[model samples]
Target: MVAYGFKRWFSPQIQDGTKTHTIRGHRRRHAHQGEELQLFEGMRSLHCRKIIPDPICVAVLPIVIISSDLIDCGIAYIEIDGLPLHRDEIEPFAVSDGFSPDRLRGIAPAALVASTARETMGRFWRSTQPGSRFEGVLIRWRS
Candidate 1:
């Protein structure tokens, strides 16, 4: 099974069926739909220090790419079948596309657009430079 690793803070959101979509750098080869993804935590920090063995969450969810855009930079929205998690709950640090305020305004409703500037939801509009090959991927989480 294909496995993806996330930070400790965000991993639980996935396991609990809270965060359904993950926006990330695009992948040259995407995981096929209906494939079970092994969820791992602390993989990013594993190279830095020898931490305790991280437990692998048994929850495997099917994911799909629901949206892709190449305007400012390439981005893919992957959707997972799980309970919807609002942006406030996750509390992202920064918005990936904050540089393009107009884009955010255009796509999101006026109310949402207004909230994008607030601290809680600001990260959603934050600018994130696209990766060399792939912009990003949105992974949908499924219970």
Candidate 2:
């Protein structure tokens, strides 16, 4: 089984099934649909723990996150499997990835609560390099 690790704070959402997808950097061997996936917290650490029963990977798709020239203004373009996301869909998508403003209270700026998920995600993905582009994978489980 392919294993994926998450931070401890994500346990509640992962266990409750609210968060069913994860965005990650490319893997040498990408996960395939129908594969069993192991979810863990703190992999390779002494505090490691299983977060949930293994879940079947229902989908695995290409994902790209690009920061806009207006990145500082909270603008970004995101695509999944080559299709771009509509403006209205960003928030729900972000929530599914466990980045809802309320959930990011301490890790994100206080201004985030008043900002859109696009802003939150933009700031997050661009934390290190505001203009960087991220090519990754989106792994999902049936809800």
Candidate 3:
């Protein structure tokens, strides 16, 4: 399973089905339809303090959003079917991972990055050091 990590603040949006697509900063690995992705909390002290060892959700990658840029180096949109983790189930795992609930307060929304995808993005993220290359890549769903 491909594993992706996100910040804690954004977990609620994923859980509630408000946020559908994740706009990645750089193009990572190619994601196929129906691929299962494990979503966990990343360890970024600035955004989220707690590092949720266990994945907060499992999602299937159904679509990948493309961009109009001539030189697109990163994925534009990552559509997922995310199922939020229950607090009861996650608490035990959190403790085992060396984090306590008390330390998780007031964090920003979590960002997600698939494991394999992370490798690809990591390269780009490092190359573009000192500044984030995240641009606006919007995908509009048609009903």
Candidate 4:
């Protein structure tokens, strides 16, 4: 149902045509799913100032835009299950635990993350070094 190593631009509805209903696509997509106990309660409410205890999931890819090994200005991330997403490499960090997360809604957000979709474009990812912190638990979405 989801096999985008690159090529998806965007989608939020499900339907084809001929009176099927539920077809959505404007352009903008990426993917990833390798492991999970469950993540995305809305990215666990976006929290992470630094909560290290047992980091090391290393499945990467939550965001990407073609910067390469970021941190030049301090803007590169990858803390899935702990929410830090902002580095895509053919975005594919949510299949082993894929359900949701990596959405853009009506498309419009870039005060931090960027994209080009190759799964987002030129990825190397970052984050998770605060003593290798990232065991899990940071997805929050309540609405």
Candidate 5:
């Protein structure tokens, strides 16, 4: 079985079936459709815990994430399977990936609820250095 680890914050969403997918940097081996996946949080640590019962891998798509200061958000947005996400689709996409601003810290309650998906995702991707591009896969599992 292919195992995937997520951050502690994501455990609730994953357990509730709200977060169904993950974006990861590319590796020589990746999960494929029809395979079972082991999802956990804090793997290899004393606090490690399983987030959800095993779920079947449903889809895997190529992904590219580009970060640039020129863009409003450090992220230039992302492309899945070679197609860029439309402006209107960014918020929902970010939300699905558990980017709900209210769940984040250091933001005023008012602004937390006000942050758009683009803004939230941009902030999330801020860890990537500007001008760098990340190539990876979008792995989805059936809920």
Candidate 6:
């Protein structure tokens, strides 16, 4: 499966490019009857009403992503399937939209990767962690 994340530059005047990320990690499991494909839009899920499909083929599975197009909230968006659905689509069913952002909060597990920024990302998720269920943060509304 492949996923891409896009981030908007905080300052439009600057020439900073959006972050393009390829989804990594997470082994296939039988739980949810192999039907439990999930996505987190930063701290919030797109909404509960949104039903997602988990593909059986690994060579070409659906790419789930989380991203935000709204820049004012400074909220990082999470996109699953690269669909254009907004917060309104999932608000009715969303369970924890208000939860504190943990995307960059707890990275202690990445300590062994060294303290440098480049090494940190490399160590934390340059490659997917074994047994981990989710992918690392990709596109932040701003970061």
Could you say which candidate leads in TM-score? Answer: 5
- Which stretches in model 6 have alpha-carbon errors above 4 Å? 1-25, 28-30, 34-63, 67-76, 96-143
Error of 1 at 137 (Å): 2.7
Q: How many backbone clashes does candidate 2 have?
A: 0
7-99, model 2: which lDDT tens digit per residue? 765677899898999888876886789988999999999999999999999999999877765645354667999999987776788778876
Candidate no. 5 TM-score: 0.84
Residue 52, candidate 3: how far off, in angstroms? Answer: 12
Off by over 4 Å in 3: 43-143
Query: In candidate 3, what residue range of length 10 has the lowest lDDT sum?
Result: 134-143
Give a tens-digit lDDT track for model 6, residues 37-92.
Answer: 33222223343221123222222223333323233222233345555347554332
Q: What stretches of model 5 exceed 4 Å from their correct place?
A: 105-114, 128-131
Model 3 lDDT tens row, 1-143: 34445546556544544444343433456333344444455543445332222232223233323222233333232222233334343333223222222332345212212223322333333344343333422221111
Query: Sorted by TM-score, highest first, which candidate order results?
Result: 5, 2, 1, 3, 6, 4
Q: What's the CA error at residue 9 for candidate 5, in Å?
A: 0.8
lDDT of 1 by residue, 18-85 (tens): 45544455455545556655556556664533222322233334433222234222222323444433
Measured over all alpha carbons after superposition, the RMSD of each candidate to the real structure, in angstroms, is 10.7, 2.7, 14.7, 15.2, 3.3, 16.2
Full-model lDDT for every candidate = 0.40, 0.77, 0.35, 0.25, 0.76, 0.28
**Cand. 5 Cα-lDDT:** 0.76
Where model 1 places Cα greater than 4 Å from the true spot, the runs are: 47-121, 124-135
- Among these predictions, the greatest lDDT belongs to 2
Residues 1-143, candidate 4: write the lDDT tens digits.
12111112122211111111111122253222232211111232343122112112223333222233433423233443344555452244321122122443234233223442222222212231233222322221111
Superposition error at 40 for model 3 (Å): 0.9
Candidate 2 residue pairs in backbone clash: none
Candidate 6, residue 44: lDDT: 36
User: Tens digit of lDDT per residue, candidate 5, span 1-143?
Assistant: 89999867667778878889999887778899999999999999999988888999999999887766576654566799999998677777877887677554433234323356566666556644344687889999996
